[model samples]
Target: MRLLVTGGCGFIGTNFIYLMQERHPDWKIVNLDKLTYAGNRKNLLAIENNADANYSFIHGDICDKTLVTNIIEEYQIEAVVNFAAESHVDRSINDPAPFLTTNIQGAQNLMECARQAGLEKFVHVSTDEVYGTLAKNEPAFTEDNPLIPNSPYSASKAGADLMARAYFETYNFPISITRCSNNYGPYQFPEKLIPLMYTKAVAGEQLPIYGDGSNIRDWIYVDDHCTGVELTLLKGQPGRAYNFGGAAEKTNLELVRELLSILGKDESSITFVKDRPGHDQRYAMDFTVAQNELGFSPSVTFAEGIRKTIQWYQDNELWLEEVKSGSYRDFMAEWYGER
Candidate 1:
């Protein structure tokens, strides 16, 4: 099978590519990434000289219809897994225009291009945040959860999810979507909560804790998310959306404590901060659909995943350093400027 993975150079996307390369030797993988601030080609260095005979990379944007269509035809891609988007909630609050452009517009562009290209399967990766925070004593988010996105980022993703389902129902496009929980693992940009707190705590600097740190989220390992996505793309029913969960729910304070402990830092390392506007109080996922339908279950528990992730940061210290130095930003500016 030949697959085109948008944002494949980014965190979870890169891990997905690596996982596929390891498990399926005969499949060809094409990584299409815009190389934005969060996207880094360095994340893919492990695949530079691999045993897999079919792997390639393309630097492009999902919004470019002609480019997307051309690549689909040239590569004879049988499947497309879209992971591209403006994902930061705070950043989306700062500037929602970009989120609208990428998350909603870009999704529409890709959907139309895939339709024109005769695509076989298209899996749209999404987040459970689209369901907003569960009310007090409410049930966890299920596949039938109504989208009540709280922030611009989640709203835009919800818009994209709607479009994905629309295309499938209206045009009979072979599309599936998986709304997953918070993912934490290596290659994640330091801006997110996990990497951000880990970096500051390790540097002996104050770790910023938003609000009282009582917000809850279902944290899933990035590798497990990749596997679940793969299963959904292969065995999932078309036009259906799956919920992928780690069954690991933790409050933000608990998460910070875990990070501090893993980094061998003291309690003094933490600093409480102002709350985010429109912050969701909690998020949980009921992943029964994915488990029963795709046989997808997380292999790594939350505690185990955290240990592995912390070790990765320790071993890849130089990577963390370079990322902090801002060359990645410069590279994105330079590369995207020419395009």
Candidate 2:
């Protein structure tokens, strides 16, 4: 099974690539990553060093139509799984142009190329953020929920999701969309909540919390998300959308406290800060379709996943240092500078 996996260097994509390489020894995998601030080639050093490995990496953006088409044709890509995008909500709020370009335009380009190539399946990895916020008492988001994205990051994703749906409706394209919840696992860039808090708390630095720390999010381990995506590709119906979630819901404050507990740190490291505009109050997913059809369910509990994640960060301090230096410093300063 030859496949083109875009954004294979990012957090979730990195994990997905590792899972695929380890499980499908005979499958030829081609990874295309722009290697943006969040993407690190070092994440796949083990696989890259394996002489017998059937994985290749391409450093390029998904918006390049010529490059996308050439790689698909050259590799005889049987499937396309898109994981590339500017995903940080804060970054999107600061600048929305990159998000629109990469998330929407990139998706369109890849889908067009895939259609032309007649790929067997095209799985578009998405996020539950496209459903917007839910009230505290509201139920989790389902596959049939309306797209009411509240952030630039999510709006771009929603646009891409709609585009995928449109392709299926207009051209009978074999496309499946899977919207997953917040993912936390090894090699996750420190910009996100879990990694950011873990790094800060470990260094005795202040762990920033936004908007009274009441925002709730459903968390999923990266491996589980990858499995869900894989299952969706293998068994999911075309023109259908699925939701993958950990069923673990926690507020910002709660998650921070859990991290502090795991790290043996106290609340002294906590600091409340200003919330960004269009911040959603809550997000949860009801992945019944993925569960019933794809036989997908999260295996890692929140506590277990958090413990493993914290240890990964602790053991990979060198990686943290490298990624946190240079442009990452500038990004942090730009986002948290005023706070």
Candidate 3:
């Protein structure tokens, strides 16, 4: 497959690229990224340096129609797998405009360009956050659930998802959308919960827990999410949306305790912090559609995935340091300094 993967330098996108290179060595991949503060070029150093690499990296924005169109024509692209967006909830809360511009407008632009280019497939990577929070006893979210996004980040994604569906309906564009649960694994930016906690815990810094730490999420391994996306690109029907979940639900407190146990720490290491505005209470996804139709289900357990993720951070100390420096330092201070 000749593919154009936007946001290819980011967390999940990087993992997907690695998997594709390993399993489908002959496939050519063009990675287009805006190289935002969160987009670390170092994530794909190996692929860039490999003599036999079939990878091409372009530093640009997806909102640029000319650049995206040129890439499609130049690469003879057959498929588009969009993983690009301003994805941090805290960041989105601090500023929603960027999220709206990149997630909603950028997505629409990509789809329009792809439609005009007559691409064979467009796979939109989305999150379960679009379904909003669930009550403790409420059923997990399914593809049919009404979108009730509570945060700016999720609201933008929901808009993009609807746009993708509309494109398929109105233009007969071939598009598949995958809504996944929380993902934790290698190459993840440290600002997120798992890596942030892991980084702080290792440094003997206080691990911040928001709003009594009871918010629940279903955690899927990064590789598992990548696998589901691959399946969607390969087998999913147009105009259909698939939910990919790990079926592993853990509260924020429970997850922290587990990480503490793994790190030989105690509860004293954690500090309670005021929760962000409109924080969802819980999220769980029913990925039966992906399981039944695409033969996609998470293979990594929470315990195993957590261990692997922590180990990855521990093993790549230099990378951790590099990522933590520069703009990330300012971000950390600004976010945590208030707490």
Candidate 4:
């Protein structure tokens, strides 16, 4: 059961690796990551020296079509689980070029490689941002929701989602796309809202709340999201999209205030900031298909997840500090503790 798992060093990817290792120790998993700003080898250190012979990590870019094909052929990879992407909305707003090249071209590279390889499952991990914002009282985004991505980050993902459909319709290649809500968990880069607030709150800094902090979103725990992805690959119908959501709705300000309460902090830490241009007002998901079809639903409550996440950040202050301070810039040399 050898599989290709891209972006395995990123936050959700890291947690998914740990889950897979626990569930299927006999399965050989190939982890490919580019070690981008958000990718950190330290996140995978716990699995590095394991004697289970179930894992290996490769430093490579997903946009390299030749390299991607070579690895798939060399490994005889049976399935492709794509978690690679330029995911930060803020970063996308700042520089859309990298997001476009990596998200769109990189996905094309993988799809062609998988189509040629005849992989059984080509699962593309995506986000609900593709559906854009919803009007008040509008039905939550289901699998049937139209693609209306606003930001460069979401536009790139939406582009890949369509291409995946093209491959499935044109050549009948097995493909599955999973659009899940915002994810929060351990090892998340502090650039994200939850982790950023956690880091700042701990350091006596003000937390930036954007646009009156009224933007609403459904938050899912990273582990629960992994479960949905795993189930979708094995039990889901091919050529279909699934929406995995926590169904726990909260405004940005509400979420931040909850975090402050959980951390025993006060609201004084929050400071209103200039809102991001074209920021989606709200996002919600209806996971009916994921629930009834794949029997998948979010297992962790948002509150429980947020509390655990806050604790994780507190415990892993050293790693968070390195990432925030750019100390991970020396990863190439000190990757495996080679000082």
Candidate 5:
């Protein structure tokens, strides 16, 4: 397959690209990433170093219609999997403009380009936050759940999902949307929960918990989410949305305590902080449609996944430091200029 993967430098996108390369070595991949603050090109250094790797990277934005259209024509891309978005809820709240531009407008651009190119498949990767917060006892969100996005980030994603559905209904475009739970694994940006706590704990910095840390989230390993996406790209029915979950639910406090235990840190290291605005109380996913139709199931349990995640961070301290220190931006500028 000739595939175009957008935002391929970001966390889940990076993991997804590696998975595809391992599973389908013969496939040609063109990765388009804007190299935003969170999109570190260093994440795919191994692929960049491989002389025989069938991968190409384009430093650009998904919002550039001319660039996107030309890339589709130039590469003869058969399919597209869009992983690009302003994903952080706090960041989105701080400024909603980027979220709207990238998550909604950028997605529409990709879908329009792919639609015109007669692309065989298009998968818009999304999040469970689009369904809004769940009560402690509410049933997990199914794909059929109404979208009631609570934050700018989730609202933008919901807009994109709706646009994708519109494209399918209006033009019969072959597009599938996959919404997954919180993902933790290697190459995840340190700003996220697992990596953030791990880095802070390692540095002996106080670990901050929001609102007594009672907010709950279902966690999934990154690779498992990638597999679910692959299945959706290959077999999902057009205009349909699918949910993927790890079936592992953990409260913020529980997760932090577990991390502290794994790191041999004391609970006294935690400091309660004011929760951010529009913080979701809980998020859970019911992926029965994905399981029944696509034969998808999460392979890694949180206990195993979290351990593997911590070990990966421990082994890649240099990478973590570079990210934390903002050195990668300098390297990226140099790399881009040289290209």
Candidate 6:
């Protein structure tokens, strides 16, 4: 397969590219990334350095319709896997303009280009947060759940998802959406929970927890999410949406405490802070449809996934340091300073 994977320098996209290369050696992949604060080119250094590798990287934004269309034409791209978006909930709260531009408009551009090109498949990677919060005793969110996105980030994603459905309905576009739960693994930007807490715990800095840390999220290893995406790309029906999850639900407090324990640090490092506005109380995914149709199931348990994640950060201290650029530090300080 010849694939154009947008946002390929970011967390999940990087992992997905590596997984595809390893599994499908003959496949050619073109990575289009904007290299935002969270998108780190260092994540794919190995792939970029290999002269014989069938991989290519284009530093660009998905909102650029001309660029997207040209890349599709130039590469003779057969399919597209869009991971591009403003994904962080806090960042989206801070500024929603980027999320709107990238998540909604950018996705529409890709779908339009793919439709015009007569592409075989397109997979838009989304998050479980679009289903909104669940009560403590409520069941997990299935694909049929209405999109009740609360955060600007999730709303933008939902907008893009609806657009995808529209294209399939109106233009007969071959687009499929996959919504996954929280992902933790290597190459993840440090702004996320696991990496943020891991970095702070290792440095002996205060680990900040939002609003008593009772909010819950389902956790999935990056590889498992990547596999689910690949399956959707290969087999999913048009206009259909699929959900994938790790089946591991942990509260914010429980996750932090577990991380501290893994690092041999004490709970004294944890500091409760004011929670962000419109904070969803819980998010869990019911991926039964994906399991039954795509033969998808999470392979990594949270225990094993967390340990592996921390080990990767430990081994790649240089990467951790390099990715913590000036902008990242400023954002972290400013965002947490108010909390």
Highest lDDT among the candidates is held by which one?
3
Each prediction's RMSD over C-alphas, in Å, is: 4.2, 0.7, 0.7, 5.0, 4.9, 0.8
lDDT by residue (tens digit), candidate 6, 1-339: 999999999999999999999999899999999998988887889999988779999999898989999999999999999998888999999999999999999999999988999997999999898898999999999999999999999999999999999999998899999999999999988999999999999898999998989999999999999999999998998889999999999999999999999988889989998888999999999999999999999999999999999999999999989889648889998898877
User: On residues 78-138, what C-alpha lDDT tens digit does candidate 3 reach at each position?
Assistant: 9999999999999898889999999999999999999999998999999999999999999
TM-score of each: 0.95, 0.99, 0.99, 0.95, 0.96, 0.99
Candidate 3 ranges beyond 4 A from true positions: none
User: Which tens-of-lDDT digit does each residue in 103-215 have in candidate 4?
Assistant: 98899899998988888888999999999899768999988889999999999999999998998899888999999999999999877889878878888987888879999
Count of residue pairs whose backbone atoms collide, per candidate: 0, 0, 0, 0, 0, 0
Against the correct fold, how does model 3 do in TM-score? 0.99
Candidate 4 lowest-lDDT run of ten:
330-339
Instruction: After the best TM-score superposition of candidate 4, give how far the Cα of residue 301 lies from its true spot, in angstroms.
Output: 0.6
Runs in model 1 with CA error above 4 Å? 327-339
> Worst 10-residue stretch by lDDT in candidate 2?
326-335
Per residue, candidate 5 scores C-alpha lDDT tens digits across 137-178 of 999999889999999999999999999999999999999999
Native RMSD of candidate 6 (Å): 0.8
Can you tell me which runs of candidate 4 are displaced by over 4 Å?
327-339
Overall lDDT per candidate, in order of appearance: 0.88, 0.93, 0.94, 0.88, 0.93, 0.93
Write out the backbone clash pairs for model 4. Answer: none
The true-versus-predicted C-alpha distance at residue 297 of model 4, in Å, is: 1.0
Model 3 pairs in collision: none
**Backbone clashes counted, model 1:** 0
Please report, as a residue range, the 10-residue window in candidate 1 with the lowest summed lDDT.
330-339
